[model samples]
Target: MIYLDNNATTRIDDAVLDAMLPFLKEEYGNASSLQHKLGRTAHQAIEKSRSSIANYFGASSKEIYFTSGATESINMVLRGIFERYQSIGKHIITTKSEHKAVLTTLEILTKKGAEITYLPLDNQGNINLSDLENSIRPETILVCLMQANNETGVIHPLAKIAEIISSKDVLLFSDTTQAIGKYAFDYAKSGIDICCFSAHKLHGPKGIGGLYIKRKTRPIQIEPLITGGKQENSLRGGTYNTPSIVGMGKAFELISLKYQEQTAELRNYFENRILQEIEDTAVHASHADRLCNTTNILFKHVKSAELMPKLINIAVSSGSACVSGDRDPSHVLTAMGIAAEDALCSLRFSLSKFITKEELDVAIEDIKSAVQKIRKDSPIWQLYKSGVL
Candidate 1:
């Protein structure tokens, strides 16, 4: 199958997998134990991964904390801050299109009586800066937003928001899960206080991800989400997953070396083909800046769910894998004010660095034909011919 669902998750790079095997087998030991040879070996590997990830983000090694995925990392930052600084501020701000990891966490906090304001998005899925500014109060302690949207690949104006939040004393937490290896990110330069990412999105193994918190930033002081041992700077406590974390580091090293060139080509090739082909299809959020490999499209009369199955050879997502099984309309699109029927017709196609131009050609041909058939079969198209759609 031609896997275009790279945003949802990606196949671990063979080289990264190779780097992980020894840890999973011969070196399998609790990283917290350092006396024994096996444990020492595992401990060294985990520290190396932490250092590697920190260097990639221009952070000190101590600032990096590993977790199961971006979801957990986001929760760690949000709930941690809320619990620690409850007296500092009871209000938080976020955008409407954040991944459930951020939104649901905020939702739970809201239910617990923390005030929250979800800023609205413009037509191209960008957060309104004025709304963001207006939402901030002396009581607002945190502002959270994702660097890049998973569904549309639209890059949010993080630097602008960071500057705005800087004016206030509020801490800014950005979910960089989609932007980590695809685009350049500098936590210090951006003035963001906390950032989180999943390795699998960057061709690393699943089950390992990281959080970066700036030093001098208020210590994330929430009770541990999982408590057992004092590990991960006492912020996250558990024996590390040596193999997957090592694999994640290897993935970062390899991707960082070729990121600029690969991503430029990625964006260029996809845009060139889509512009030349794909009649009657509208690229969502095309006017906004986006990551290199992600493309979300709305094929007017076609059902994305129905088309996805027919194009089984091409792996893609209607929105997010988190909500893949749900028949309900993608809340993201609906929140952006896309019509319910149109939201059902939208598809998110995230390309991989490994996808060849020939594969894109084949996929585009498949999509074009599929759309033609779908549109022809659609009763809405017949209605639209008489100006009824």
Candidate 2:
């Protein structure tokens, strides 16, 4: 199958697999056990991986905390800060376009008496900087936003938002799951207090991800999410997955070396081809800056749920992978003022390092043919033909 669903997950890179093979086989000692030679080998590998990941974000290795994936990282940061700072103030701010990881977590926190203000998104799925500024109050202690939207691919005004939140008592947090490998990030330069990312999104194993908690940003005290083992500086607890961690580092190294640039070119080619060939199609977040590898499209008369299955060779989605199961229209689209009908018809296409120009052309052809067939059978097409919907 042609995989245009990189945002959902990516195939593990061969280099990453090669890096992981030893730990998964011959070097199977627990990283936490330091008494034996095998254990020491595992322990050293974990530290090197940690250091590599930390270096990518310009952070110290000690500040990097690993978790099962981006979802856990999100929960850990929100809970860790909330549990410690709820007494100082009970307010949090976030955008309506965040992935379910942040959106759902915030919902749970809201039920526990935390006041939440969901920042509004513009027509292009970008948070309104003015609306964000107006939403902050004395009670607000944290502001959470995603760097690039999982559905629309709109890159948020993180630096501008950081400017607003930085001067306030609030701490700025960004869910960078879709951004980390797609773009460059420097925790020290972005004014971001906390950022979360997943290795699977970067062609690594699915079980590893990390959170970057900036040093010296003390708006909220952080407590452990899991107690025992003292892993991840006591923020997360468990025996470390040495092989996956090593694989993640290799994936990052690959991205830094070459795939990132090539992927950007492929994405651009795909977007250009789509616009040039498809009629009555609109790209979501067109007015906003976006990650180079993602594109969200709305076919005028077809539903993604109905369209995706028709194009079995090309993988895509209606929204974020975490909430794709829901029948409800995407909250991100709704927040951006898109009509429910249009939102339901939307599809997210994320290209990858593995996708070539030729592959994208083939995928686009498959998408176009599928959309044409679906539209021919759609009632909306009949209404539009009669000049009505």
Candidate 3:
């Protein structure tokens, strides 16, 4: 199958696998065990990997906390902060178009009496900066937003968002999962107090990701989500995931060496073909700055649920992988003011560095033919053709 769902997860890079092989095999040891040489070796590897990823985000090694994935990282940081800071103030500002990881976690926080203000998105899948500024209040202790959207790949104006809180004591947290390997984000320079991302989104192994907690002289006090061991400098508590951590470092090395430039070109070529061949198609967030490797499209008279089954060769999705089982229309699209009918008709195609022009050519042909076939059989298409829909 032609894999066009990189936004969900990417195939592990060969180099990443090579780096992790020894850790999984002969180098196996608990990083917390320091009495033996094997344990010391494992500990060293974990620290080196931590330092590498920390440097990428403009953070110190001590501030990077490893977790199972972005989901756990999100929950850990959000819940930890809320638990500690709820006494001072209980307000959180975020957008309605966030992933289930953020949205669902916020729901739990609300139950604990933390007030949440969800900013609405515009037609192009962007939150209004003015609305964001107006939403902030004296009791607001945190602003949680993602760097790039998972469904539409639209980038949030983080620099502008940061500017809004430049003088405020409120912390700024961004879910950097979709944008980490694809773009430039400087946590220190941008004044982002906290952020999280997963390795699987960047061509590394799953089951590994990290949270960046900006260090201060006084130290930030976040209640621990898991309190047992001393892993992650008391931020996260558990045994270090040695192999996956090694793999994550290698994934970043590969991105810096080549994947960024290659993937951008491939995405452009793929999107150009889709627009040229498809009739009555709408590319979500096309007018806004977006991640280079993603495209969310609406095939005007066809439902994506029906079209996806016909285009079996091309792997794609309707929305975030975490919420794919829901039969209802996407919340992200609805937040951006897309009609429920068109949101159901939308499909997200995310290209990666591994894809080729020849593969894209086949995808374009198969996708075009499938849309035509589905639309021909669809009564909705007939109504749209008659200008009655």
Candidate 4:
């Protein structure tokens, strides 16, 4: 099958799987058990993996904390802050197009008396800096933004936002899940206080991820979300999934320049072919800086539910996996001012590092064929052709 849903989850790299094998078998030991030799070995391996992953984002090993995935990491940051600092302030700022992980957490925070201000996005899927700056108030404790959008793959101007919020007293947090493996991220330079990512987005195991908490000079104060053991320096409590952590290290280490060069070429070629072959098709965030491995297309007269089932050989998504199964239109598209009908017609195609021209060619053909068949009885297409739309 032609897999183009890397944003949802990538196929595990063979090398990463190979590195994880030993830990899943004879080397399996609890990282917290320091008394035994086997347990000590596991603890050392986890620390080594943590350091390796830290180097990629220009962070130290002490600032990284492991989690089940981005969802858990994000929850810990948002809810933890609200629980710990409600007396200081209960205000948080975020973008309208954030993944449900951020949006939903903020929703729960509101119930706990946290005031939220959701900044609006422009047509290009970028948050207006002016709107963001104007939204900040004395009560604002955190500004939660994403490094890049999941549905459109649009990269936000996080550095500029950092600079804007730097002079202020509020902390800046970003959900960097989509940007971690696809683009270069410098945590120190970006001025992000805390950020989250998932390993599965980068060809690592699905059940592992990390959080980068910036400590330029002093550590940021955050309360424990799951209070139990002293794992992750008492910031997070749980037994480490040693094999997944080892595999995550290998995956991050393997993201080289060659993969970026190859995947960018495939993504551009596929997008070019789709626009050329299909009439009335448009790509979201076409004028903005987007991830080279992602392309979100709006099949103007077709419904994604109808189109997807027809293109059985190709795997893509209408939106994030968190909400893809629902009949509701993608929140990301709708936030960019897309009509509900058109939003339902959008499809996100995220490419992996190993995609080739041959796979793309077959995919292009299948996509075109699927759209043609799906639109055969579509009243929207009929009305458009009749000039009554």
Ranking by TM-score: 4, 3, 2, 1
- Write out the backbone clash pairs for model 2: none
Q: Against the unseen true structure, what C-alpha lDDT does each candidate score?
A: 0.84, 0.84, 0.89, 0.89
Instruction: Tell me how candidate 3 scores on lDDT.
Output: 0.89
In order of appearance, the predictions have TM-scores of: 0.95, 0.96, 0.98, 0.98
Per-residue lDDT of model 3, residues 268-354, tens digit only: 888888888899997988999999889999889788888899988889999999998889999999999999999999999998888
Instruction: List model 1 lDDT by residue over 22-57, tens digit each.
Output: 998999998988889989999999889888888888
Backbone clash pairs for candidate 1 read none
TM-score comparison, 1 vs 4, better candidate: 4
Ten contiguous residues with the weakest lDDT in model 3:
252-261
- Deviation of model 3 at 171, angstroms: 0.3
Off by over 4 Å in 4: 216-218
Task: Report RMSD (Å) for each prediction in the order shown.
Answer: 1.7, 1.6, 1.2, 1.1
lDDT of 4 by residue, 1-389 (tens): 99999899999999999999999898888989989987998898898889888998888898899989899988999988777777778889997799999999888878878899988888889888999999998888899999999989999989999999998878899999998877765677888899998999999999899899987565577877787888998888889899999999998899887788788888999999999999889998899999989899999979898899998999989999999999999899889988899899999999998778999999999999888887787887988889998
